[model samples]
Target: MKISATILAAATLGSLFAAPALAQETLNFGIISTESSQNLKQEWVPFLAEMEKQTGFKIKAFFAPDYAGIIEGMRFNKVQVAWFGNKSAMEAVDRAEGEIFVQSVDAEGNPGYWSHLLVHKDSTLNSVQDVLKNAAELTFSNGDPNSTSGFLVPGYYVFAQNGVDDPKKIFKRVINANHETNAMAVANKQVDVSTNNSENLRLVQARQPEKFANIKVIWTSPLIPADPIVWRKDMPKDAKDKIKTFFLTYGVAAPGKSQDQVKKEVETLAGLQWAPFKPSSNDQLLPIRQLELFKNRNKIAGDANMSETDKKAKLAEIDAKLADLTKRMAALK
Candidate 1:
């Protein structure tokens, strides 16, 4: 009787402890909504299905309205893994103890994309200078303020050059939107111009060709690094290893497939493919931080209370930091 009772007690405790591990084994995968919810899911389903098969863990998809949602998710531990742009990945690293482990490479083998300031093709605004020359007369749409290409690129280049912190105040009217909304607004002539990225433009070409045909890119910013895959620093070593191994080996066939075979297999998974990650670090974020630094320097330059000597000192400091950032950025190339 005593032996039977002890066995029952041990079994109950074992099951109680096992429940948490089983429940937590599922990864909460967070993604920024670069496409419609349905389309986004469609793109990821195959990739993640393979990821799960390889990693032996279930990944439950979590979608966010904007980048900030994923940042907050990581900060609060609601998400264990995420796909983040360079800027947002920086934010996650700073605020959420996140680490960048991998990045995507385009089919062209460039691990970068561009930010574009787009205007209606039929509009007379043919150049960025033309838009800046009449900033107050035009309606504009800047995508989410958290977005790097959608906000930071245009903010630092277009509005800062025009000496306005409140871009909305300078323009006749402004709308804060996501990439899709911005593309639609520009295509429909609902706004004179808007911010967009190369990735979203591809989606537009595929899903809304007529809209894509209507928009003309007025300016393209310097190549922004590709988005990164991030995971919490505190996650278990085994889980992290599994995540890295899966991504690094993901698209490339194991050394023997013909070019045709690889292409056909790759087409089945529509997500960007870069087999074997480059092993990224926070240095990947220097340019993004530099852009933020640009915004700060621009603001300081406009300060009326700072004397000439003080302004000179501050600008010098900013320039020195930028020099360091520039060197680090150039080294990565």
Candidate 2:
């Protein structure tokens, strides 16, 4: 009787302990909806499935409505791994203890992409400076405020030259949307000008040649860091290693002629090719860190619509925070 009772108690304790352990083994993956959700599911889904096969773990992807949501999901530990643009990746590194695991290399195997200022082929808009010079009379399209090439660099280029807060004050109106939408808007003649990444435009040209032919890039910004694949610092070491290994090896298999057809449908960006991913250090985010400071102080606060007093006050507060955050980010190096 004594033995029976002891055995029963031990079994109960074992089951209780096993519950949490079992739950922790399940993997959660995440990707940002910077592109359409349908596109993510259709194209990236297979890449993840292949990763799952290689790693021998069940991989489930969580798609966020926007970039900010994905960054927040990483912060709260709901998702274990994510893909982020340079600007949002910096935010993730700051807020979520995130570490970059890999970045997409070009077809030539280089890790860089550029920002492009796009206009209809027949439009007279010559340069970013020219657009700002005649701001109010022309129409403009911008990527979502959180976008890297779409918003950050383009906004900085215009504001830095104009020496003003709101570029819209000069333009008839500033339209904010996704890069693809902006490209489409410009091609359709819905807006006179817009900005997008070089890689995205390549994809557009490859997939929709006719539409892309109607648009041309009038200016290009300096290279932005390649988009990064990141993982939560808190994720298990073993799991992180497995994920890193899988992405690093994913593109190694050579595609046959038939595979070329598939590649055409899967990849939209021209130079972008799947290379093994490397873990990116937050150090790469330094440039964007500076850009963020400039944006908050000048762009956000300097909205021409806001009163001068309000703008100055907001700028002061942002300056203080940026100074402190910059110090901390530097310290991490």
Candidate 3:
């Protein structure tokens, strides 16, 4: 049957666009590598397998080398869904228009973790103050700038409150590493002091007990928000719903799987998954954003290019705003 040229062109274009709408081909999930990338891929096999079975989409991982990599990937739409640290997730939400759908809980099913500043077991440093006092004499390592416990919590709770001009500058030298590397650095005495997390320290303990045991947590920050599972806000609604269901229902029983069997699967990734989790919103990161704002304000105060008069005026303005935020946060109780 001959068709009109206009109709033929319309049909061809429709098919081209409709192909994806008809079949959900692949889900590109971005994961920031806190540990070794190889281990992450391997540990994810069971979870990914179940996700694929439930969602009917071939899942491919975008294993980013650092926290910023995944954030940037989501910003450019190279990543549709991602597992992100709280601070990194905040970055994704702010810069990539990402939304938080769920958060991970601990082994005890609590949605939080500790931010720790670590020192060698044999080191004389006894507290965060010790590190600050010896800042000019010691080397330091901060977690990825976007990490929650690694950078955000410690950056605010430890370094910022200490009145240190810059944690990076106070230390004789500064380096950036992931949680695992930071723990190992403290263990090996490669860095005099480093920021880490209780959960990541536990992970290292599981994989290398000796190294983990040698590193001691000198200071611990108050409970911080757990890592969040995020997806691009522009993702298809149906896909987002399905993905949410996959997480909310994971480790639950299926036709052939026993509840205990499912429990074991989630247990294997203790620090990564939360079997009984709750949906979250962008507001989960308000405190984190506030911290970043304070950090930026401090940087402005230390601006060498600004005239002394201007710098003092800016500092006064920032301090007033910060005081208001502090009061509001306290009132949240």
- Give all TM-scores, in the order shown: 0.84, 0.77, 0.85
Q: Candidate 3 on 39-86: residue-level lDDT in tens?
A: 677666667776777777666777777888888777776677888888
lDDT of each: 0.77, 0.70, 0.77
- Number of clashes found in candidate 2: 9
lDDT of 1 by residue, 1-333 (tens): 000011112224234224346433567788876546677777777777777766776667778777888888877767778888777888899998799988877655667888899999999998888887787899989877778778887788777766876677678998888888899999999999999988888888888998999999998888888878898787767667778877776656766546775564477445543333556777888988998888889988999998989999999999999999999889888
Give the candidate order by descending TM-score: 3, 1, 2
Clashes of each: 1, 9, 0
* Deviation from native of the Cα of residue 47 in model 1, angstroms: 1.4
How far in Å is the alpha carbon of 17 misplaced in model 3? 11
- In candidate 1 the C-alpha lDDT for residue 255 amounts to 66
Write down the TM-score for model 2: 0.77
Ranking by lDDT: 3, 1, 2
List candidate 1 segments past 4 Å from native.
1-24, 255-265, 268-277, 305-320, 326-333
Cα lDDT of model 3 overall? 0.77
- Worst lDDT 10-window in candidate 3: 1-10
